[model samples]
Target: MEDGKLTVRAVERALDILLCFTDSSDLSLTEIASRVSLHKSTVHRLLASLEGKGFVIRDASSDKYRLGFRIWELSANMTHSDDPALILLPEMERLRDQLDETISLYVSDGLERVRVQAVQSNQAIRRVAPIGARMPLHVGASSKILVAFAEPEVQQSLLASPAWPAGLDKASFRQQLAEAKSLGFATSVEEREPGAAAVAVPILNRAHRLVAALAVSGPSNRLTLEKMMEHAPVLMEAARRMGKMIK
Candidate 1:
């Protein structure tokens, strides 16, 4: 019984270490030790174990630890289970058919947004994002909408992080978020990926908290700014329908 208890405690401690990476991308041994209230030696040992398991990787130059691909693999697996992707697939397909452009569903994961599901556009020239693609939250319309409607704490946290957009200051970013909220959707043109334009709306839960973002993307030449605005109502309505269905 003591052995079992020790194992459980160890698991909890490891989880604590992993959770630390959610807010900060990299950490030194001392930083992690202070964050988890563990001795430096203990933290070092835990990090070693996690490293062996491919959960963390250390930078050779900085010696700071960052989350590894294993975490991304596990996260991708979770996106398949108990996620709204399945429920949103039909809607995505319908939206794709309507616009003849790509439709994707994105959810926030730490400081990034993951494309959980997507229906590619049938058009000869269109935007296409793979199902498991992960991208910075400050880059695209889908990600920005997710950030805009997120909890105030999350918004503030992201705004203050180094991952925040380099071109936009905190005040400007906040204003953009406010504008997205006021407009009920977000739009981007050649922001993240050149030649791609997108319009997105937040999918909210019954409590009106953001659950995900639904976006329509296509070639900028075809999906011009005017076209994006024209499709905003359709995307917003689809988002609302998804919110209701998921709730």
Candidate 2:
């Protein structure tokens, strides 16, 4: 492939626009310009070119533009296919049943944690979050464990963000992350979502790198903070045992 100089400004604005699509469904020209810190006309021109190239689509009714389905198609093809989801689901189910709570497995995706597998408890009252849900690293027990065990670069990127989006303040998040790493387990009390509490521990490979996080979650009333701490050891052991069995 031949290499040539690309317009840095154009490239930067394009990335800014693309990043805006992560959490937002649709954005107007003004909103995109403000978020990207580019002039309205400049953003409009870029959006027009991107739309022509099938990378961005405009909603006529709302007069807003967003990432096109082309991005989804590309991303779906790029997701991990060799991970332990298939090999670990049954074990996760057993753990969930034994504990009478939800068990989930997550892996680091950049600074975020993505749920790859889950097993819901048979209890009538249980929390159920599906697979493929991406969560903030600072919030839930599973996500925090993933962040605590991540490589230094991954942790640094999350900490360096201007606004931590997991409903956690920077200082509090840092404190929890440090404690979790030292303790080899993570517990959260109503941090990720309302009325939910969880405990999790990292699954490490033979090389001591994090492969996944094993977590149990339930309603805050049923899974009190005290009970979560008590159950931490159980979850930690399960994660370790599964890690050894898996890749």
Candidate 3:
């Protein structure tokens, strides 16, 4: 092969090794070599290069390789420019029109969640969450949904901080998050703002990682607990559709 083609082949082989770990957390050298259809020595060289770059790590006890923290670091940087609001705006509009309630998209930002986009309700009385508004992750439905589906490390860090919402201890907050994850959605009534209620569902990427939260909010009188539950399916369906559109 030409020099350029040889370089491309090498890159492809390296990527093939990385992809092998997707279905399983850890793999032995022989397993990787077989999966990639490469010689054991070639696989060893590629694995060493990947380990040096912090893309994979070997377990000293088991002699198996697994993804390294650098993969998450790269994913974090990707999120910086990933604005799911652009993809979710149309779905938000559809939800707003269907329910005549305010629809908002929120993404995790440290211990807080930021409202990236919103479609307002035409009703005379409705909850209005301004775009760019930041709220505590432990409070509103949208914020809590973002927190509930956050990476385990991120979730633990946020829960340990003083940013935990008032009136709920760490244990209680953890239970709530567990419940949210179990139900595949979250609800809030006067948690963030008096007389405001909301229900939110997580928008996940193809990897099943949280990308954003889709929520509908309105006055407590209009969005009572029962009403919110009734509308939960709509919000979840919209979230599912949004997830497919986002990267």
Judge candidate 2 at residue 225 and give its lDDT: 81
**Which pairs of residues collide in candidate 2?**
none
User: What residue runs in model 2 are displaced by over 4 Å at the alpha carbon?
Assistant: 1-82, 165-168
lDDT measured at residue 97 in model 3 versus the true structure, 0 to 100: 95
10 residues in a row with least lDDT, candidate 3 = 75-84
Candidate 1's C-alpha runs over 4 A off are 1-82
Task: Indicate which candidate wins on TM-score.
Answer: 1
Candidate 1 per-residue C-alpha lDDT over 66-185 given as tens digits, one digit per residue, 9 for 90 to 100: 999899888676654446899888888999999889999999998889888999999878786777677888778987798888878778778778766577677866788899999999
Cα lDDT tens digits, model 2, 107-174, are 88876788888898788889886877788776788877888888787778888876566655788878
* Cα lDDT for residue 15, candidate 2: 74
Write the residue-wise lDDT of candidate 3 on 118-234 in tens digits: 999999987877776778877778877888888898788887887565667778777888999999899999987789999999999988989988899999998999999999998
Cα lDDT of candidate 2 equals 0.83
- Give candidate 1's whole-model lDDT: 0.88
Q: lDDT values of the candidates?
A: 0.88, 0.83, 0.87
Provide TM-scores for the models. 0.68, 0.66, 0.66
